[model samples]
Target chain A: MSRRRPSTRTVLLAGLAVTVVLAGVVSFYASGHPDGLEYVAHSLGFGDSAGPHVSDNSPLSGYGVKGVHNARLSGGLAGIIGVLLVGALATALLYAVRRRAPRD
Target chain B: MHVPDGFLTAQTSLATAAVAAVGVGIALRGARRELDDRTAPLAGLVAVFVFAAQMLNFPVGAGTSGHLLGGALAAVLVGPFTATLCISVVLLVQAIAFADGGLTALGTNVTLMALVGVWVGYGMFRVARAVLPKRTASVPIAAAFGAALSVPAAAATFALLFAAGGAVPIATGKLLTAMVGWHVLIGLGEAAITFLAVGAIVATRPDLVYGAQDLRPDHADLEIRDGVVV
Candidate 1:
């Protein structure tokens, strides 16, 4: 069979839909604790040994907007923002990579 | 796992960077040929989905949470070449934009998550497809196993990296045991999510699944047989 080619619009739309749905699912299902790596580091006694994050000074630290009172909402919104930003940025980068090829 | 800046020694970071650079270079070259219209956009979508999925961390024992790694998921959704590029984009975005991972350690992160994770997970899936029943349902099972195994494999990779370049004093055995042990449970979560995601995709758009080549029959024989065509 000839290769099936999904349009750029279709791909982007599908990606957006998947992002929103997965974000919602994960936000609802996510646990209220540190992750495995954090736990391992803690259990191994290097939890405190973690050097300060260079981005600690950034406005949104630890994937949460500063000054947000609601913990769950803050984190959930942060997750959404992260998804959108990462998706957009990656698409743009890849588009550039595909577009800016020297003539063969 | 997203290794931080100061987590590993300079030597370790440099070595991992070299490996990642080579892997990405290979992926880029391969992608030029493999990523056509359908795969190209689908690859981008997979990256977004992986990014979103990784954000949702499920709780493990002792209140520890784990999220989807997406190496296997990407590989199964797109081909391995595009999968590596997709995941590498996610990691790059995470490191640069969100600072989720360390900037200096981008090479290590990509090497572990993109190359190693994709190969192990996709390799297992390929083996499973050949040995297991030839059915659409089996796709999810294979995906589950692939996704589950990928996590601990990644943890093991990290443990190895730590062993070589670990700055903090810790027993390698304990580290390995702990990393692998926790990741095993984490892998279960990954499997469930991958199974569900891949299943949903296959159900809605079988055409989108690159890994479904084994399941698709020459003639459209849509039957519900366990060992037969799915």
Candidate 2:
């Protein structure tokens, strides 16, 4: 089969689809308790026992978005923010790489 | 395991920091060469997809939920070199911006999640592809195995880190057993998610999927031969 170039539309749509699904998942059905690792730590004694963190007072501590009501919604928003931040960062890095590449 | 701050002693953290620095330095150099015009954007997309995919929590027995680590997915989509860079970037951004992980333990996180996870997962993928039927189905199966296995492998890496720099005087064997056991279950979810993602990419853009390249032409031929063209 002859290769066809993927349109920007495809990438955008796919990216958006993935992002929305991620937000929905994070918003709706995340485990409320500590994850397996954390649970193990707790059962074995060490959970909540972390030494003082320098940024413990950060606004977005413990996966909670400050001033956001509805815990699930806060987490969902945080997830969305995470996606955007990471996506933008990755895109910029790649863009720089692309820019520096020798033109064909 | 996302090592929270203060989990490891300062000495251990600093030591791993040096190790991680070297690992990342190597990865950065490799990425500069491996990620070309075609591969670079795709790699960035893989990272974004991984960032998004990691949010989807699948149930692991008994109400526990886990997400995709994506080390396998990235390695399968890109190469090991680029995969490491992609994961490191994601973890770094997560630690700094979201505070999802500890800054002090960033080195440990990257080494385990990026280096160990990607290599182990991709290695499994190559082996599975070599053994399985050379077709589109193999892509999913291999991806599933690679993704699933990466969890325990990563858990083991964390266990090692904990052994070296653990805050609590926990038994290494017990910790490894517990982590590897739980992660083995979580690995199933990782496999499922990875299979679906790889299947989607293979279905739509086989050329873009690094792991699917070999199977694409043959699979497409088989589809035509069977009168079931995609």
Candidate 3:
């Protein structure tokens, strides 16, 4: 029997599905500790130098909805939204920059 | 690493911003060649995956966590130029939507993660691939090596930028050591992720993996007998 490789559409959709699960569900279990730079900064006595982000008041600030009280839902929704946004932006950018089709 | 605002002075931020701008401009041009009919969809998928993977910050040690920088993974999945653009898009979305990285520090973040991470990772991967056995199996191993070093390279670049325009006067040496040390641990995670991701993609769809393109089965099937055409 011939081994049939998955089509590009199938692979892309599968990859997207995996991304949704990772961002929406698995992200909830991520560690809450400071990352490498943040930890090192505080350890070295410069952590306080960080200024508040200008977008701190945005709805998606801190990776959660502004009014959403449920931590899990908020973070999951935010993650999924972020995934979509990244996908949209990246696809658009690639379309603009990628080589044009001959028929066009 | 996300370099927040107030960490570096305005001058430093502006300088880095200029650098990021130029780097991204060049990447835009280069990506035009790397991205075409077949790879554009894959590139978008990579961008989204990087955004998602970045959210899952696994702990390294001592209460410090590390997430996927995704330079090597992206470089292996897509080409280096497209990888840089993909990461820049992820950073742009994160800053605007999630307010994760500071607006003023956007340039620094792009410089460190997008430019430095992608180039250094791709460069290292090329070096490792050249030395390792020329086979599809070597792609993931080279990608892992590239991923492992990319994290600390980004960290060290941050340290250099901080020393140049840090808001507070701290021991640069100590900061560098700490940053590199922690990132070394994080790089291990990066290596693991790159290894698994690249290995899976290479195993399933070797044609789609940019890094493994040269090691395609047809290339290995070449029989140049007596330096003459078969």
Worst 10 residues of 2 chain B by lDDT: B216-225
Number of the candidate with higher TM-score, 1 or 2: 2
iRMSD per model? 3.6, 3.0, 1.7
Which of the numbered candidates is closest to the native, going by highest TM-score? 3
lDDT of 2 by residue, A48-100 (tens): 65665555565655555778888777777776776677778877765664326
| Model 2: how far residue B6 lies from native, Å | 1.3
TM-score of chain B of each: 0.92, 0.89, 0.94
Candidate achieving the largest DockQ: 3
Please report, as a residue range, the 10-residue window in candidate 3 chain B with the lowest summed lDDT: B214-223
Across A1-104, the per-residue lDDT of candidate 3 in tens digits comes to 13567888888888899999999999999999999998998889999999988888889989898788999999999999999899999999998999977894
Q: In model 3, what lDDT does residue A26 have?
A: 96
The candidates, ranked best first by DockQ, are 3, 2, 1
What is the CAPRI rating of model 3's predicted complex? Answer: medium
Per-candidate fnat, comma-separated: 0.44, 0.42, 0.90
Overlapping backbone residue pairs in candidate 1 total 1
Candidate 1, residues B96-209, lDDT tens digits: the string is 656677877889899889998888888988888887888777787888889889889989999889888887878999999999999999999989988987887776566568
Q: Which residue ranges in model 1 land beyond 4 Å of their true spot?
A: A1-15, A24-29, A66-73, A93-104, B217-230
Compared with the true structure, all predictions reach lDDT values of 0.78, 0.77, 0.92
Please list all clashing residue pairs in model 3, or write none if there are none: none
